[model samples]
Target: MPLKHRFRTDAALGLVQVSPPLIYALVMLAAPLGTIVLFSFWTQDFLTIDRSFTLNNYREAVTDPLYSELLFRSLRIAGAVTAATVLLAFPIAYFVSFQVRPARKSLWLFLITIPFWTSYLIRVFLWRVILAYDGPVNGTLISLGIIDEPLSWILYNANAVVITLAHAFAPFAILPIFVSLEKIDRSLLEAARDLGESRTATFFRVTLPLAMPGVLAAILIVFIPTIGDYVTPRLVGGSGGTMIANMIQTQFMRLNNAPMGATLAVIAMLSVTLISLVLVLATRRWTRSR
Candidate 1:
């Protein structure tokens, strides 16, 4: 074959190799997102889309107190969950990465991930059972004489939502932190110790700083998903724990208001996107500064 023809043939083969994934990305992700963006702007009648561009839905979502309250509540719950998960996961991750024997660490990691093998809905409902009046938690509390009556308050509240989400996302928080901690050079810690730093000081000055990347990753993983999650909050959060995603579901399903639902979704999406971007930038700066 001529050199020019050979180059063209190789180029064609390369394009063929890349074509499937490129097409799949366009179809699966870009196409749906494009449609959603279109839907956010387009108004719909009860059963039909009018297709005219209007900002009425956006206006209603922004101006409505109910929507704003739900949005804020979602943020608060997700933030609490994220914080709790990170706090609880950090020490566990530190131990697993730094202290554990390599042979035993894999088993520990597997145990941590066991819950994830079950269905998410199943896990949420399991919490409902665990926290119910006759459930294990209330029973234990009552047996311990902590309270005369079973606390119904514990079963369906924002606190429950936070706790459940934190539990659910704990492994996510742990894995990232473990990865980050594992990446740290042991020589650095030895250097800190040789310099006469105490254990606490060594952790703060050496280990924690190095682990910040994983901490930030865990935050992003937990915060972003938990903020948008409607499932756990809906199951356990009764009235006060209702989040923005639940509201979105009601709009689309119960109310049959697609435009309004899309508007809320887009708003929430924007909020999450902006917050995530800020966090990622801050984390990058923290990493760079160290």
Candidate 2:
């Protein structure tokens, strides 16, 4: 049967629009994921990957304390980034959406995304330079007499990782929030005002509730990718700042343990997915309660 005869015009149009991306995803994403699943169950020796199946990789991944620490560290750092990104982005998003004249909103939003125009690696290194012992931060502090000497604690640690990731993901967090805020109905604020609510109260009561979806989107966008970021941690995250992705990279490249790496990848993916599901459910509950 012809597609048009089998489905209505709108349905056919929807399918047509979706099919290209779906096929591309299947080829690019699904195929690699399926391969990783297979590799996760197999064993690898010093040089050769064993075709035989085994549960040892999964066992080792769970039983090892180092993996857990790195996983937890990644989660904690990613969570901090998510919170910081959302908090910082919200004000800018709110200003652009509600306060800025419509004519210049696009320009302001374009400025938000200007960071992405630079190479990501360059940005990471730029942070390193800014936070280095004798760098601008220390130089400024010394000039202002805030400190007598350069601080050695700024660049190479978890704090640095969180700061860099939060900065890197800020635009992502902001755009979604801006989109959400822009979608809020103007009449909702009018309704709140007519009820004798103050400006702050109206925002808290009406605007926030309506903007939760965008906030949630911003959180997920920042949280999910930052947790697995290898480059940021590798560059600025000294000994104590390594995340789960760093270990996975070690397993795959340094140790020549593809199976273990694949297993770790799977575990990290599942863990992130589980946390995201819980967060989504909790947000839904909270919104419903409100």
Candidate 3:
């Protein structure tokens, strides 16, 4: 074949290979998102949906105090969950990456992923039972004389949502941090120590900075999904724990307002995207400076 013809043939083959995923993405992701965006511009009145393009849904979503409150609450809860999960996950990832024997690392990772064996709904329910007023946590605290009675604050509140979400997302945080830790060159730590840096100093200057990409990854992983979680809030989070997602569900299912629901969904997605971009850029700048 002529060189130009061969190049064209290869380009056509590449397009053919890419076409399936492109079509799949359009069908599975883009189409639904476009529909939601379209719906968000329309209006819904009880059982009727107005197809006219209007900013009424966005106006309500933005101007409504209830939506704002729920959105802020969701952000708070997601932030709390991300912080708790990442803080707790780092030590475990460090231990697994640095302390464990190479042969045992896989076993430890397997153990870490044991939570995946159970259904997510089951795990959420388990947390519900574990945190319930009369459940094992309260019972154990009572037996230990830590409290006079079952603690009502632990469950059916924002605390319960945080605890459950943190636990649920722990593995997600741990895995990324572990991968980052594993990629770290041990010689760098040795060199830091040789330069008279203490264990804490070495970690702060060398380890933590290098591991930040994974930490950022874990933060995004936990924060983005937790903000939109409705099941945990519905089951364990009482009125106080309800987030924007629960409100979205209520709008769609109970209130018969799909446009409002779509609006909330889009707003939540935009908020998450904005926050994620900020986090990524901030981390990148910090890492570059380091």
For residue 80, what is the lDDT in candidate 3? 94
Model 3's C-alpha root-mean-square deviation from the true structure amounts to: 1.8
lDDT of each residue in 1-290, candidate 1, tens digit only: 88667657878879879999999999999998788778889887788887899999999888999999999999989888998999999999999987899889999899899989999899899898998889999889889999898987877889889988988898899999999999999999999999999999999878988889899899999998997789998899999999999998998899878888888988998999998899989877876776
- 23-111 per-residue lDDT for model 2 (tens digits): 99999999999999999999987998788989998999899999989999999999998999999999999999999999999899889
Off by over 4 Å in 3: 1-12
Query: On residues 35-132, what C-alpha lDDT tens digit does candidate 3 reach at each position?
Result: 99998998888988899999988888889899999999999999999999999999999999999999999999999999999999999999998998
Name every residue pair that clashes in candidate 2.
none
Candidate 1 regions with alpha-carbon error over 4 angstroms: 1-19
Task: Score residue 58 of candidate 3 by CA lDDT.
Answer: 89
Model 2 residue 27 lDDT score:
100
Mark the 10 consecutive residues where model 2 has the least summed lDDT.
3-12
Give the runs in model 2 whose Cα sits over 4 Å from its true position.
1-4, 7-17
By TM-score, the better pick of 1 and 3 is 3
TM-score of each: 0.92, 0.95, 0.95
The CA lDDT at 157 in model 1 is 89
Count of backbone clashes, every candidate in sequence: 0, 0, 0
